[model samples]
Target: MPFIPHTDEDITGMLDVIGVDSIDALFDEIPKELRAKELAGVPSGLSEMEVTQLLQARARIDGEPTCFIGAGAYDHHIPAAVWQITTRGEFYSAYTPYQAEASQGTLQVLYEFQSMMTALTGLDVSNASLYDGASALAEAVLMAVRANRKVKTTRVLMPRSVHPFYRRTVRSIVQHQGIDLVEVDFDTETGQTTLAHCETAGDEPFAALVVPQPNVFGVLEDVNALTDWAQSRDALVIGVVNPVALALLSPPGDWGQNGADIACGEGQPLGMPLASGGPYLGFLCCQQAFIRQLPGRIAGKTEDVDGKVGYTLTLQAREQHIRRSKATSNICTNQGLLVTAATVHMAILGAEGLERVAAACLANTDRLAQQLCEVPGVEPIFEAPAFHERALRLPAPTEDVLAALAEQDILGGFDLGREYPELGCALLVCATERRTDAEIAAYREALASTLAIAEAA
Candidate 1:
C-alpha cells in the first residue's frame, strides 16, 4: 500500500494540540548543525501507478532463481489457508493485546502460538514471540545470565557452528553488558562442536552454553553430551534449535541427563515464505524455572468468576516506555501476523502432517547431497548427520562456483568462506520439501559442470 501523508489541516491540528506553532519547533532540542537544512537525495514524489511500475521493473532485474540456499531464512511450502486466514482484518489489523479485558481473540492466538512452540521445543512454557531468530537468541543468552544466580562467571561459551549472523547479533547485544562470548571451534572432520570442546572450555564461571542443533553448517551437534557438559559445569544450557528438525530429532527439553534449560530458534520454516529476507518469526521457550526472565510477553489460559475460558497478557517484563534498568527486555510487541500465520499453518498440518513434511525434507536433502557429492571434487564436509541443509567442500572457491550455477539459473548455496575462513571452498546448501527430484538433479548436474569448468579454467 502507498503511504498517505497527513493533510495540511491535520498537521496544523496536531501541532496546535502539541502547543507547537510550526513543525520545525518539534525538534528544537536538537542542535541546528546536526539537522539537515534540506532533504538531500530525496526522490521526487511519483504517482501510485508509476511507483508500482518502477518497483516491478527493478524486481524483474532481480530474476528469481531456483533457490538452494538456507543460511537462515528458508523457502518452504506454506499452506494457502495459512495466509488466507491470517490476512483477514481480525488478525491483520489487530493491535497489541494489552487490554486484558478486550483482546481475548488476539490473546488466544498468541496462547496457541506459545503452546505450539513449547510443544515443539519440549519446554514447559513459551512467549508469544520475539523480533527474529537473532534477537531471540540474544534474549535467551541474557535470560540465562540473569537466571544463573550461583554462577559467578560472566562468560558465554558458544560454538562457531552457530549461525554467524546470530552470533554477531548476540555479541553486539551482550558485550555492552560486560558479557564475554568465547567461541568454540568445530571438530575439523565432524564440523560439530563436540562435547570435547566443552571440556576444553573448562570449568569456567560461564553463565550459559549455546548449543545450535543442525548448526550453521547444517551439521547436527551431539546435543545430549554437549548439554550434559554445560550442566556439569553448573552453567545453563541454551539450545538454539531448528523447529522443523525438532519433529525428527530429540528436542532440547529431552537433550541430556536433565535436558536444556532454555530453547529458542527461528520460526520462519513453520509457515513463512522467504520474502527476500523477512518479516520472520522468532520462537523462545524454556522450563518453568526461568519463566520470569523471559524477554517477551506470554499469554495464559484462565477462567473468570463466571467460569468462562479467557486469555490475557499474563506477563510483560518490557519497560513499557518506563524505566529500563529493571526491565527484562525492551521489546514491547509480538510478531502477531507472523505468529498467527504459523499457528494456522501448524493447526492445518497437525502432528502427523508436520512429521511427514520434516521426513520428506530430510529425505529430499539427503538425496540431493548424495547426488551432488557423487560429482567429482564435491564431497560432504561433515561426518555428523544433517537435516535439510548440509555443507559441501567444493573443488573451487564457492563464489565462482555459485556464479557459474547462477548462469544456469540456480540460486546455489551460501559461501562459507566469507564468514568461516577455515572452511575453504565450502558451500552450505539446503533442499526443502519444495524441491523436486528434477530440481535436485539439475543442481547436481549444474554444480558438476560448474566445478569442472572452473577447474579447467
Candidate 2:
C-alpha cells in the first residue's frame, strides 16, 4: 500500500462531520495533564528506501551471539517450513474468524493448536491463546479464583521460585480485585518450594496454589506433594510449566492423585524464536470441569448441516462477544499468527521427535554445567536435579562477568541477584538442543576468562 497524505481540506471536512473543531478535540475526554504535548524523541519521517537502509544497518549492529540465557524465552531450532506456511497470504493476513464459513482454514489451524496444547499438558481442555506467558498466568490466577467454588478466599499461594516477572504481572492484574498473592519462600538448598512453606499460611483457606516445574532456578519442585496438599485443602493447583520439558517430566494434569486444575506457560520453546523478548505465545489449559471459566476463545470441530466436518469458534465468553457483567474475561483476541507457527512446528515434530529434542536439551545443559563447574570459584548453587537450565554461583559480581562475556559476543545467562538478592552472585544458564558442544565450550572459556579478569581487578 502506498502512503497518501490527507490534505487540510480532507481533515477539516472529516472533523466537521464528527462535530470536532480539531484533531486534538477527538481526545477531549483525556485529561490535559496526562496528554503529551509532542513526541520530542521521535525522529523525523524518512523515505521508504532510507528507512530500509537504516534498518539494515541496525540489524548488522546486532551480531548473532551464541545465547545461553533461557529465563523464560528460549532459543530453539525452528523448522524452515513453520514460518513459510504461517506467513502465506491465506493465514498471515487473516483476522478474527467472525464468520465460520469464510474462515475454515484459520479456524481449523486454531483447533489443531488447542488439541496439541491439551495433549502436551495432559489436560482435558485448552484455550486458543493468551497475550504471553506472564499475562496467561494472570488470567489463570483470575480463572482459579472464579472456578474454585469450594475455596471462598481469594488468596493464592505463589512461590518465590516462580519467575519474578510473572509474579509481578499476576499481582498487578489481580490486586485491584481483592486477590491476595501470598509469597511462599523456596528452600535455599534445593532451590525448590517445600511443603513446609505453605503451612506457614496457617489453616486459613487460599483459592489456588501456583506450582512451577523446573522453577526459575531451573530446579524441579516436588509438585506431587504440593498438588496433593492444595487439593486436600480445597485449593486449586495451577502449574506454570515449560512445554518442551513436558515431553520428559510428568505433565501437570498428572501431578497428584487428583491432578492440577489448571496449567499455563510460555509456548515459545515449541516453535517460536526468542526474537528479543517476544511477540511470544502464551498457552493455557485446564480440566473439562473448568472449561466455562477458561478465558480467551476456543475452536471446536463439528459436523455441518451436510454432515461434513467443519471448524468454528466456540465458548467465546469474552466481553466483546457477550454481556460485560457475565463475560469470563476481557481478553479480546488470540495470537493467531504465533499459534499457526506453533501448530505447524508441533506437527513437523511428532511425539518421538519432541522427546528426542527434550532429551538433547537436558544432556546439553548438564554437560555445560559440568564443564563450567570445573572452573575455579564456580559451582552449582542448588543440589536438586534440573531440566533445561541451572543456577551457578560465581565468585565475582554476576553483572560484571556477564558484561565481559557480552564483549566477546557470547550471550551469557541471566543474573539472579537482580531478582534473587539472597542468592548473591548467582548466574542462571541454559543449553538447548540448538546449542553445539563447541558453543558450550566457548561459553565456559569465556566465563573462566571473565572471572579471571574480575578476580585480577
Please, what is the TM-score per model?
Answer: 0.91, 0.91
Candidate 1: residue 204 lDDT (0-100): 61
Candidate 1 lDDT over residue span 274-357, tens digit each? 987778878899899898888887888988789999998875545454546688887888788999999999999987888888
**TM-score of predicted model 1?**
0.91
Kindly list the per-residue Cα lDDT of model 2 for residues 1-457, writing each as its tens digit. Answer: 2487888889999999999899989999999899987898998888899999999999889898889899998888999999999999999998999899999999999999999999999999999999899889999999999999997888999999999999999988887889989999999999989999889877899999999997998899999999999999999999999998998989998999988999999999888988887788899999999998999989999889999999999876554567576788778888999999999999999877889999999999999999999889999999998999999999998898888899999988999989999999999999999999999999989988888888888
- Candidate 1 — which residues are off by over 4 angstroms? 1-40, 317-323
At residue 433, give the lDDT of candidate 2.
95
- In order, what lDDT does every prediction score? 0.88, 0.92
Misplaced by over 4 Å in model 2 are: 1-47
Worst 10 residues of 2 by lDDT: 316-325
The pairs that clash in candidate 2 are none
